[model samples]
Target: MSVFSRFFPQAQVSLVHCEENQVILTAKNDKTAESEKRQIRLIDLAREATPATCNLNPLLFNGHLQTGWTTIKETTEIPIYYKRKIFEQEIPALAGQFAVDFVVPAYPKTTDPEATDEARKYTLPSGLPARTTFFSKEELAALPSNDTKPMLVALHGLTGGSHEVYLRAALAPLVLDETAGWEACVVNGRGCAQMKLSTPLLFNARATWDVRQVIKWLRKTFPNRPLFGIGFSLGANILVNYLGEEGENCLLNAAVICANPWNLDVTNIALRSTWLGAEVYSAHMAVSLVNLFNQHVDELTHHPRLNVDDMKDVKYIHEFDRAVQCALWGYPTEGAYHRDASSTDSLLAIRIPFLAINAEDDPISVKQAIPYDEFKQTPYGVLLTTSWGGHLGWFELGGCRWFTKPAANFLNLIAKTIDLSVTPMPEKDKEGLYGETLANGSIHKPSHPSVFYPVNRKLSMTIDN
Candidate 1:
């Protein structure tokens, strides 16, 4: 399947390149790609939009690098932090982020396996209990006996799979454990079976009000340990907004968000109007929401509000917006809700070390959406834009184990931020081309070296305890 077809069914990939500050993706297809081939669907964007009525920065001053003005027949002196390039490597794509040895030890036949036992007390409507998994602190305990390791809470983006599935299946064992030495706890944010979200509280932003409660419990149980939060897309938006409003009060040391839609109103509108933005992008989100709400008897039979069938011809975001608005509040549009829930206006107030990861190509997170001037000047916030990684799609560029190394690097930044010197990997007989040390003290040399060119940024962040 084409990259666009696999990642974003609705939008077309007119252009894909590693731009300096972000990955630039121009839309060519906005209709949903076939479901069987869909990988991860992100919202889409137009190269240009309805003249932004919003006056973003009154203190508006733009600093552009020469390339930012390329072919424009003018010279501007905005600083270019890094060079932009389009790279294609000839090698089997084995990124570090996806490299994990999945081993499920046989569940030793339980002595007395009972469905309704106290040990299995956390029952689900699906007849499943609050399933819990405890990851060993071996890596953290070994990081340094003198200090406590930071704990990382991973929240997945929408439909990105198990709310905490990514953490348990991919991050915990493979990347986070060996390198960062973080105590990784993957919690299934609401609607997930283990930690099901109340039906009344599922779709709206207020649902996030509960994360603070979760953090409180974690802090109380594991006193004195520093905590870090990582969120993607919807999760990212929720986390950033929460941090902005609350300011990392109880146990948060640092946070990172990937592919977050900065402007909710524009994004909501874009998903309704833009070619790829609305057609396929918003449709999926609308479908998920509609399907979720259909479980509500009152919502299902209600007219004016959308039943799943009512959404069959629902193509644009505006229609979906109308449906949701009607169901949520007796309204016919996405006005009041947009103003109340969006985090676009709240970014200036954010005062934590927030690392936002986004791509220009991601439909949900557009370049214009980033309040660059507002965020860049803020002492505690920095936006890391990449060339590619669809929605949460920032994978290893070229043939490097894209997932493993880069993710490890980000996790390392978190641990390092806490002033903990992440132990460098042990000596390897032979290291991979990307320089990542293999776990078995031996490197698996593919037919060709994996070539991943990292956008070099002088990370001068100092961790002040």
Candidate 2:
């Protein structure tokens, strides 16, 4: 031992992981065989190591005090920075797995059983069998009793359910309120969350039929109530595609999407790239998808279209899509499915107010993968790109997540823009329709292709005088 170490007899501290402003450390002492470990404030460690160099601004580093959005530029800003340094962006991005792994201890834990017990499950009416879990009226008591308030429909990512950590975190900000509180439900894809598939069909990024059924059911179940949607990752891609496909006829007043892989082909390429992308992300997702398929292997093997022998060696996401998803869905090949499934082609068709939030440093969906030009072209869509917030890991100190509040705020803002109380023009007026004046004083003629048309034949509408 060095003379200084012998005199001081201090325990050796090594960093296990450093995420944003938090550092997990393991300490060992020559005097004792046991090792001690704990999480400490990174700023404190920096100050202890070099006080003069470690003078971090509390506004940027203090997690408890740091709340609310940092307006970096207009609608886009650095969202809830645990550490404001540019180089430190990767810390939280890489720590996403750690956050997810200890989700129970990090945040209030909820399981599938717990969620099912509190919710009313209903199978959606669609070509392919799917399910939705609606929170009981008792659980949503904070919402307006008269159904004036909007319902929040959330969609989970690949291999995720309503009880997933990120889903729970996203819904944390919602609570019972007279006007502001929104009732929520999770629209699970076919075979997800233990929902038995009645058909041999499953959902893909471009498949919006299940979403349509869920919205239709919600509208029928709760008349006059507006609807809003929030989708994560794969779910986000589906929502975006649905919005594009339905255009002005969409039931949703607004939507908030996070970490959407708009370009499936590009995203797949990124996942299959080098050490971090291939070994970390692609391998992890591939394993999860394969395991999910394995659960239904007996039924899948019986299907004449699917090659059971090919599925046994499925090791990559592309392989799974090629072997099972594409074959079952009747797509000629995986490339065809990916091409049609990409939401980028349909972004311009979306008419409702929508917000898409993505982290620039997100490892799975690289910064270059986003279609910034397309976002600029879309009048109603806003892209909020944060410098650092690893894929779905917008974590703050003290277990406080950052994405939910801003998302809710955006939802509320858009909800105000839509006057759901306005009744549709009478069907008789459709014959004599010439031009209509919008709230913004823009006159839109029926000849205009972009003009809103009522899809429900029975619903009557009237132009505001």
The candidate that wins on lDDT is: 2
Instruction: Report residue 285 deviation for candidate 1 (angstroms).
Output: 2.5
Quote the lDDT for 185 in model 1.
45
**Alpha carbon deviation, residue 206, candidate 2 (Å):** 1.6
lDDT of every model, 2 decimals: 0.41, 0.54
What stretches of model 1 exceed 4 Å from their correct place?
1-147, 159-176, 193-199, 248-250, 295-322, 325-332, 397-407, 420-465
Q: What TM-score do all the candidates reach, one by one?
A: 0.55, 0.62
Worst 10 residues of 1 by lDDT: 94-103
The residue-by-residue lDDT of candidate 2 on 1-465, one tens digit each, is 888444433211121211221212222233544343222232233223221211212233322122122212113221111100001112221110100000111212234564444232322122111222323344434323447556787788997755555665666555334356566667766556554444455666765556666576567767767888899989998888777666656778778888888888888887787676776577678898887676656655756798878877777788888988777766777877776677775665665666777766566656667878666544456576655555765554334445565576666644543334332222122321222333322334565565442111111212111
lDDT of 1: 0.41
- For each candidate in turn, give its C-alpha RMSD to the true structure in angstroms: 21.2, 18.8
Cα lDDT of model 1 by residue, 337-442, tens digit: 5545555544433434455665555666666676666553334455555444345432222212122233445445445532322111112222233222121112
RMSD of 1: 21.2
